[model samples]
Target: MKRVLITGGLGFVGSHLTDELMAKGCAVTIVDNLSSNVMTPADYPGCEVLVGSIEEVYPTLLETSKPFDEIFHLASVVGPAGVLQHAGVMAQSIVMSGEAVTRIALQHGSRLVLASTSEVYGRAGELRESDGCQVSSDVTVRLEYAVAKLTSEVAALNRAKVTELQVNVVRPFNIAGPRQLPDGGFVLPRFVVSALSGEPLTVFGDGSQVRAFTDVRDIVSGLQAVMSSGKNGLVLNLGNPANEITILDLAQRVRSLAASKSEITLVDPKALFGPLYDEGIERVPVVEQAFSELDWRPVVSVEQTILSTLDWYRRRLGLSQHESVGVAA
Candidate 1:
């Protein structure tokens, strides 16, 4: 069986990816600190679990982690909110983790895929991998996360240029699906959770701010496509144009789907937790690169994503029956 190593195998994206990889008959090795209350591999039996930090114990763990054919580096210190809380660790983790993963993957002759964020785009408009936009200096707190990810991306690319260790980077837009933490500050899942619990759906900045959402399933498919395409040294964006929805619309939709009479409240943008949390909007991928190269496109609709997310939250809240509620505007 082909063996794959995932650095943050217990996270929302990482856990789902682990499930996908294992279902393909690939032996999976997971390295996670479980800082996020990661779902255990007991939940996914037949996978190797190494509970530790990649930055601290990766070298030793990688040495014994067996012959990995591919390495998926998904662990990072900063989510949007975590970045604001631990700027220093976020910067350190990105750089150190990338460098360590690159070295280990190269030694094992393993192909590496680094998980990156659209936050690297900053306030830049219509970002593409080929597009040259400097990381925004306006948001000093967010700058650390952006710069650290960019640094890691550059390091991986440089390593791929010289070594046989195939390295590719994926810039994932806002991904929302089941298993996301409600307190983690991801908007869609939060909305679903709030509506399920009859809590106010808080919209920041009049809810006009827009974001693109990619289903975790779609992201897993995109990752598989990149691995098959042998698209080393390439940076690709994985997202759906249809996933673009305004914050207000998202809250309304969640409430409708859950059939909850939750009130929508707009909060001050400044109250948002991320460091340098400014209210703004961003679009999805440019489609041209993803379609031509990965032969991949998101087939799921925003409505489906919303419904699935609501179902997940409802299940989490132990609600048995879902009511028929019209889609709210």
Candidate 2:
């Protein structure tokens, strides 16, 4: 079996990626600190689980002389709310962890795949990996996350230029599906959970904010394709532009699909995320590069993604699944 290492393999995205890698017959080893989304060794029965931060465990792995064939660097402080809540630690962790992983990949001659965020695009439209990112110097939580991710991207690319390391950076755009945490400032999960529990679905800022919600499964497939593309120093935007929907519409759709008597309420962003929170006006990725390079396109529709997410939450919460709710358009 091919040996692979994932830095944040227990995280929402990382965990899902781990399942995908294992299904492909790869021997997966996970390194996680269990600080954010906690998962135990029991969660991954067959895989090796190292319970420590990447910085703490990477050196020990190197000392073993068992080099990994591929490294997926997915460790970082995620979510705007979480980052803002712990800015100092988040900033330091992102930069330091990125440097350490890059060095480890170099030493092991491993193909490195870095998980970046769409937050680096700021308020730009039709976001592409080649387009220059636009971010303000405001010290806000969103900006902090974006800047740190951008810095990591630049560092990885620079390293790839000088070395034979194959580095591919992926900017995932609002990936949502089952296993996503509701309290992580992720809109889709929050909506699904609230609607399932018969609570009001909160829509911020008159709900005009548009987002292209990509399914996590599609994102995983895209990541795997990027790894096999044999392309070095390339940044690809993995998102489905066809799934673009406004916040209000999304909330309403979720309520309908869940067949719940929940109300859709509008709230101010400041009330939820504080004054420092500057919401992105719109986020839509230009995914032509992903299509051309990886021959990949997101096959899951937004409606199906929402229904599956709702079903997952219901099953986990011990609520009955709404079989009456048919597959969404």
Q: Best by lDDT, which number?
A: 2
Taking the candidates one at a time, how many backbone clashes does each contain?
Answer: 0, 0
* Residues forming the 10-long window of minimal summed lDDT in candidate 2: 320-329
Worst 10 residues of 1 by lDDT: 320-329
| Candidate 1 residue pairs in backbone clash | none
Q: Which stretches of candidate 2 lie over 4 Å from their true place?
A: 323-329
Q: Across residues 57-91, which tens digit of lDDT does each residue of candidate 1 receive?
A: 77785667477888899888645555566655678
Residue 24 displacement in candidate 1 (angstroms):
1.5
TM-score of each candidate structure, all chains considered together: 0.93, 0.95
Residue 280, candidate 1: Cα error in Å is 3.5
Q: Write the per-residue lDDT of candidate 2 for residues 1-329, one digit (tens) a residue.
A: 78899988998888989999999899999999887764567899989999888877778877657788888988887775666676666767787788878887888888888999998887668888778888786767778788888898998899788887679999999899988886667899888888887778888879988999999899888888888888898888999999999999999889898887778899986788887666687889999988888868898899999999988888887877783222223
